[model samples]
Target: MISRSVTARLMMPLAICMLMLCALAGVMIYAQLMVSSANRAALQGQENVTELGELRSVSRALQRDALNLINEPAGEARDTIAKKFDGRMEKFADGLKKLEGLDAHSFVPQDYFDSQHKVAQQLADVAVKANGGDQAGALEDFRGKVRPAEREASKVADERIEALGAEVEKLIASAESADRFAKILLLVATIVLAGAGLTAGFLITRRGVVIPLLGLQEAMGHLAAGRTSIAIPSIDREDEVGNMAQSMARFRDQLAAAEKAKEAQAELIVSSIGAGLGELASGNLEARVDAELTGVFAKLKADFNRAMEELQGTMQSVNRATTGINGGAAEIRQASSDLAERTERQAAGLEETAAALTQVTTGVKETAEGAQSASNAISVTQDQATEGRKVLTEAVTAMDDIQKSAQEIAQIINVIDGLSFQTNLLALNAGVEAARAGEAGKGFAVVASEVRALAQRSADAASDIKKLIQGSGELVNRGVNLVGQSGEAFTRIVDQVTEVSRLVKDITDQTNRQSTTLSQVNVAVREMDATTQQNAAMVEETNAAVSTLADEASRLEQMISQFKVGTRRDAPAPVAAPATVHTPAPRRSYRTQGALAVAAAPADDDWAEF
Candidate 1:
């Protein structure tokens, strides 16, 4: 299937090209409309020119027929000429009407048509006079008026026809020129659009498709070279390239898993060997390597089994020696147990003494702390009482200030009451004046009544406020007195707190001295306790060493028993003998050797597949 990038690259330019084509079509349509308009204008101009020429020809024919009618004898031939004159006049009139019916864009002016109409009328008049037997008078009228007017009208019509013909030619030329320009413009636009589409297609294909494919190729190369961690670009795209990259990503993941599994398999083998060796080092000769291994690990497993077999043989030999050592270790363990028991008893006595001393020291410290806490509490009480006194003093001062403010409020209320009384008097006077105005001041009188009522209410409220202010002032005075009493009470409390603080300070000093004496006694007991603890530690170490020896002997026997070392079932038990001390063998470092083994493996091969 075609990829999304390829589709977009093709469709985008195609769409743009379509739009350009549409625009070019629009330009052609416009050009067509312009040409159509020019053609219509040319046709109309030609028709007008043709009509004007006809009018001029008809005018000349009418003039000729009128002159001929006048020159002919007054007989049958004369009547025929007169009929011809009438026919010419009718034709001239019909032509003039047609010229006038032409559009206003016609070259002939309206005034020129008017002049032709006048000339036609004059010719008709001359024809009428000739038909009435006044031939000489008709001839004179035709020469002096009809013929001259007709010739002038003819000249103007001919000039207008020529001008209209020239205009038609110009319109045709312009239309052709515009049509050519439009075609050229469309051609150039097509070329430019084609070039742009090609260029864009190339660029999009390269960047969106070819470049991504190259990247995918490079990623695949890395994966082939065992670079499992390499990134495959364009995996997010919705195209063939993205599909390829995604496939590569999946391959990379599988490769990574395989790599990880190979490493894990190697690690599992090494860990199994290390675990068996570690158990052996910890005096467990029974430790064995067990794993479902393959490839190189299968060989490593065999080597591990051989090593274990050799180790088992060595342990069997050591087992015989441990049997003898076990007896001596038992005796030593019994002796150490007896010594540790006696030392523990002595340590117990010293521990009790030290605990008693620690208790005594803790009690003394508690008593001193209590005394100090009591002193601090008393000092805090004293300071709090002093602060209370200060707060009470401030409260009393605030009460006095409130009392003064209440008195000022009472004075203001009195002034408000006086103003209300004055306002009531003024309202009463206004009501009196409004009443004097009778019907004209009825509304004013009502307003004045309302004003008076409000003023009376205001006076009543002011009196109430004055009473409340006086009551508040009394209450404030009482509060000031109470605050003064509180201040006195706080002062007494401060004096009592000061006395209690002084007493606590004396007690605190005595307790501190007692605590110091107790601390010295506690130090001496702790030193004795430390010496006993050291002796007990020495006893415990001796006992632990003996127990360890016994455990080692038993563990050695147990370890050798775990292995299938002795082939003969009927062999007698080994005899007990004293164990001789032997220097330990030097430990071999396996870290470098294991690393070399890992490096020696065929890394390039897909071991995980196997």
Candidate 2:
């Protein structure tokens, strides 16, 4: 198409050249016509001018013969005059004959030629009649013949001269007309030659050279500007411009390809870096990359992920340990509460027993003061035990809450671990693809490696956290056991203390109310002591159970803290060309080069010597 445009552009010069050639030919033809016309006019004018001159000379000869006869004796002059008239008349007739064939319109003296010839014939007739007369009579008769005829002949001669003069004027007019036509033809020829020269010059300058070169210049400009998509103008001809346009188009394609390559290279760099960063942030370790740029980013990402995983793992371990410690603390709190509860029950029983003793003392008088003092000491001990039990129960409740939180944390960590594994798999796929991509995939491979490593690291960290949580759970169980044991021991102590109180009470009753009242009081006191011990034991068991629950919560909380489960990497789908399209590589050709070179030349044809 570009070639065609170039050819069309060149056609202007050819068209102009043809027009100029036509003009030149027209001028030449016109000049030739004028010359022919002028020559014809000149030839006809010359012939008429010659005939008129001959007629005038013949008329003069006849006039001279008539004059000679009048000058000599008529008889002697008659014969001579007759002979002269005869010769002159013959000459005049020949002149008339010459005039007769010439165009009358061309020669203005035509009427004069006719009149002179008639007068000359009349003069000749009279002269011939006078030659045979008597001498005197012939002389007289010759006078009569010559005089009148001579006068008429002279009139004709005068008219002939006047006509000849007019003929000269007509010839002059014809010559001038011919000269004007010749000049016009010459002018036209000059103009045609000039037009042809200019047209030829213009054509040579424009079509053969200028437009094609301009096109090439434009193509070069586009190339310089990095416009690889430029399209050359179409030209019809298989000429230089056409070829050049093709070449420029090819060059544009090459440049476009190079541009695409550069773009792809840049994209690869960007994708690789992006993938690497994504992997690192996602938390993978042990990932390695060998990207186009030495895989520095990928390696860095991998290392970072590894460090994060290790840190998370360590945190998880610490969390687990803390959970176990929390559980143990809760169990300890429960056991202490149980022990306190049991002690309180025991103190209560002791106080009751002291009270009974005091009553007995009261009945016995001397022992009454000692018994009262014992009762007071027992009451103080009971109050202290009750306060301690309340503190233990509160501590156990706190431990249970902490354990619940730890369990939730553990669940979250598990989720994070799963996500990390998925990320690793994705990275692995990316790496494989990059590897398969060859040179172009180098960057992607590196990113994939980083992602895989991060995933592994995250998994490891989660595993460690899980272990920690398990350990903490065990510790929580142990604490629970300790609490249970403490609760049981506390229960036994409370029972023993209650029995002492009952016995003391029974003694008081006996001292106060004789044998029957004392035995009944002892039995009622023992039953009350047993009931108090059972109540204390139940409180201790409740405290222990609460402590165990708190420990479990703490472990869960520790596990949950390990992961940010919802953390996600969002990325847009990559763009790709249709699979069916196959882009061919650049090819080499000379046509393009030659066309370009030719098109680059200046179109003015300054080197044309002509």
What pairs collide in candidate 1? Answer: 324-577
Residue-level lDDT tens digits of model 1 in 1-610: 3436433443454466558757866666666667657756666675676677567657766776776676566889888887887787788888877766776434667778778889888888888887787987997897788767766776776677557656865875666566456435643554465455445544554576446645654564565455677878988977545655665566456445544567867467547655764564444545667877776566555654554444344344345544544564565455445545554654575577557666766787798799889889888888888888988889888888888888888888888888889988988998899989999988998998898899899999988888888888888888888889888778867765775676577567756755664566456546656655665576566566556656755765574465455432334445655544332222222111100010111212211101
Residues 522-591, candidate 2: write the lDDT tens digits: 4544554565465456545545544554444454454445333222233222232222322222221211
- Count clashes in each candidate, considering only residues at least 3 apart in sequence or on different chains: 1, 43
Name the runs in model 2 displaced over 4 angstroms. 1-18, 24-46, 66-86, 103-122, 133-164, 167-174, 177-208, 211-247, 258-610
Taken over the whole model, the C-alpha lDDT of each candidate is: 0.63, 0.49
lDDT of 2: 0.49
Scanning candidate 1 in windows of ten residues, the lowest lDDT window is 592-601
Global lDDT of model 1: 0.63
Question: Which runs in model 1 stand beyond 4 Å of their true positions?
Answer: 1-6, 74-84, 105-107, 214-247, 262-610
